[model samples]
Target: MTTNLTPAKTSANTVSADEGLFKPGSKLKHKKSGGFYRVVMLANIEANLAPAYVYESLQNQNFWIRPQAEMEDGRFELVSE
Candidate 1:
């Protein structure tokens, strides 16, 4: 899986600046803090999800699968090994 550390250019001339997963089968974790949620992209999940399908499942509830991890500001590095 690929974590887009850099910004991605879209056809609309815009870049995706969020720290989210760009690959399929990627594990995305979100924690509720204060009034908003913190989204974290786990390592290797990129290998599971296909790039073409990431956006399709982005908003799908059935697709929002997360694992257990320590909570922080909500941002953490993915351990892809």
Candidate 2:
């Protein structure tokens, strides 16, 4: 689980960024809101094709799906704890 408080670490999802970094059991943060979240499931529930993730946040304790591209954009980082 990781949340980057500083803007110095993001690079708009560079090619060298970790694409598979956010998977089930991974922790993340919403940079814009500074809220923490975790990836709970990666369902094959595209319903004919959609993003394949369901996440819950510690701040709100609810589940929702975010665009996979946003994770790739360096908004969610790996928490080094």
Candidate 3:
């Protein structure tokens, strides 16, 4: 039997799909901390399949992940795409 491999959608009903906002290598800045980061890619949480953004810190090169909704909730401003 064939098995479906498609990933599940996010559980957030209010948040829209992450499209045309940013792409891989896009630069962003945190509004509160003024820290800068670069977009690595869009990822999903393995446990719940929640959409998340995979990014890297420009200051220390540490990678981080945040839910897609929070990432677009005015906390992070796009610096360059």
Candidate 4:
């Protein structure tokens, strides 16, 4: 877990693993997972990574703390406003 991922922010693949790109009120869709989520909080950067708290189910009002690596591989696409 010694990845030097800090300062490695990027918007590659449209699916962002870069938590810095996610803002509150921003919505994201995972192309592969078919999961749609909305960012509800700012990134909590720890070490070289940040976890973006996002809402996935509106019915449950539940959220998932997604790490930048998962997010990047989540195949997420920003839902344009």
Candidate 5:
């Protein structure tokens, strides 16, 4: 048997997809699928401390997430739910 693979074409959507909706040092809201989200706190880019704190808090809230890249600026940018 043979399998075929193709590369995805680059487009506006693809380019934008590479960029995050949020930026560093911005606040992010806590969100759950099929539900409303709420602003938790103001995110800061303090040596990657903010994201860790946020992740810990979310963990305490029983939120589960797959492994994701660390925020480039060491902060979380607010995202719309």
Candidate 6:
């Protein structure tokens, strides 16, 4: 199944920029491991509300979640949209 990550709509009906580049269905490559992955969704930690990216490995189909800050900290690079 493919999921599209649309920008969140606010009370003003404007699209929020919080989604950044890692949208659902986007393909990415790990800088260190050189593995490919596909983004599944964006989620927030229940306890602290920290933003995170939910993604699955293209090779093994294993799901993984990483903090948004860490995901964007030069660890992964966009491979495809």
Best by lDDT: 6
What are the models' TM-scores? 0.21, 0.59, 0.75, 0.52, 0.21, 0.76
- On lDDT, the stronger of 1 and 5 is 5
* Angstrom error at residue 73, model 1: 7.1
Q: Give the per-residue lDDT digits (tens) of candidate 2, residues 1-81.
A: 444221113343322113345766678877777888877654333344334456788786777766555565877666632
Q: Let me know the TM-score candidate 5 reaches against the reference structure.
A: 0.21
> What is the Å distance of residue 45 in model 3 from its true position?
0.4
Which sections of candidate 3 miss by over 4 Å?
A: 1-20
TM-score of 1: 0.21
Once fitted onto the true fold, the runs of candidate 4 whose alpha carbons sit more than 4 angstroms away are 1-19, 45-51
lDDT of 4 by residue, 2-72 (tens): 22222224443223433456665677877876666776654544554445454454444566767655665
Compared with the true structure, what per-residue lDDT tens digits does model 1 show for residues 7-27? 234433232323234333333
Q: What local lDDT does model 4 show for residue 14? A: 25
The per-residue C-alpha lDDT of model 5 at residue 26 equals 37
lDDT of each: 0.31, 0.57, 0.75, 0.55, 0.32, 0.76
Q: Give the lDDT of residue 62 in candidate 1.
A: 34
CA displacement after TM-score superposition, residue 36 of candidate 4 (Å): 1.1
* Superposition-based RMSD of candidate 5 using all C-alpha atoms, in angstroms: 15.6
Deviation in Å, model 1, residue 26 alpha carbon: 1.1
Q: For model 1, give the RMSD to the true fold.
A: 12.3
Clashes found in each candidate (C-alpha, N, C closer than 3 A): 8, 3, 0, 1, 0, 0
